[model samples]
Target: MDETRQRIQLVRLLYVSRAVGPQTTAVTDSILSVAQSANRQRGITGVLCQGQGLYLQVLEGERGVINALYNRITQDRRHQDVQLLLLEEISQRRYADWAMAHVLLADDDPMVQLHHPEFDPYSAPGASVLKMVADLVAKGERIRKTSV
Candidate 1:
């Protein structure tokens, strides 16, 4: 059997949390732990978005492995009204080894702000960000630029 090169399993999840007011530290802790655990269980590694009660994530790895975890993420109890925004295979893996990495946009993480639409990570939207994100990920650089 030929060794298969890793394929990035990318997915976007738009989820609304049940919590009211601001998200708590305890909640963030649990969520982070879950991300790491998922990495161990499924060999997935990528970025996550958690803000304003929404959780968006990108997972990459062997196709079978990532798809399995993607299925599980959709059914996870932590999120309600889960809608899969996007799911597609990309040519390469984004992270070197994350198991899963996350950036909390809601809590004002500089990095998240930079990447978020409002922050304008690429100075403007469109194809530039797409290429820039790919480059950053390929270089194992976390997309967390400060915006101020």
Candidate 2:
């Protein structure tokens, strides 16, 4: 193993937060830009999915970087009741290709198929949401490659 890899402790954290501001394009775009820049510098990658006035984000990076970022997120006025759903060390990133991929769960989006009328991440098991995200990303990658 490389020394750099040995010293690096990769971690992934999944959290759910309620959006304090309007979930509009202008607001989301502004937040996305800032998150991408900051995450890129820290070598972090993840996805942010918005739906039902809530935000579910998966952040993967070095332990220290993830910790600091999550701390700052907790303090951000835009997020309320920032509850962590999952946190664990990982050998590799699941969302390595994106600095911070943004996925807004619209009624017409393919991802919305996973979110039915009864489904709720806040009350449902965390693993279900993780699986949903994994499937969503996989389907997206297939479409991206085929469209190319």
Candidate 2 residues lying further than 4 Å off, grouped into runs, are 1-6, 108-117, 141-148
Q: Could you give candidate 1's per-residue lDDT for residues 60-107 as a string of tens digits?
A: 666677667666766777766554444456665556456656555444
Clashing pairs in 2: none
**Candidate 1 structure, TM-score to reference:** 0.57
The residue ranges of model 1 lying beyond 4 angstroms of the native Cα positions read 1-22, 107-148
lDDT of 2 by residue, 1-148 (tens): 8787778899999999999978988888788888888888889899888766888899999999999999999999999989888888899988888888876666666565544455567776777778776766666632221010
In order, what lDDT does every prediction score? Answer: 0.52, 0.79
Best by TM-score: 2
- Compute the lDDT of residue 134 as modeled in candidate 2: 72
lDDT of 2 at 142: 21
Local distance difference test, candidate 1? 0.52
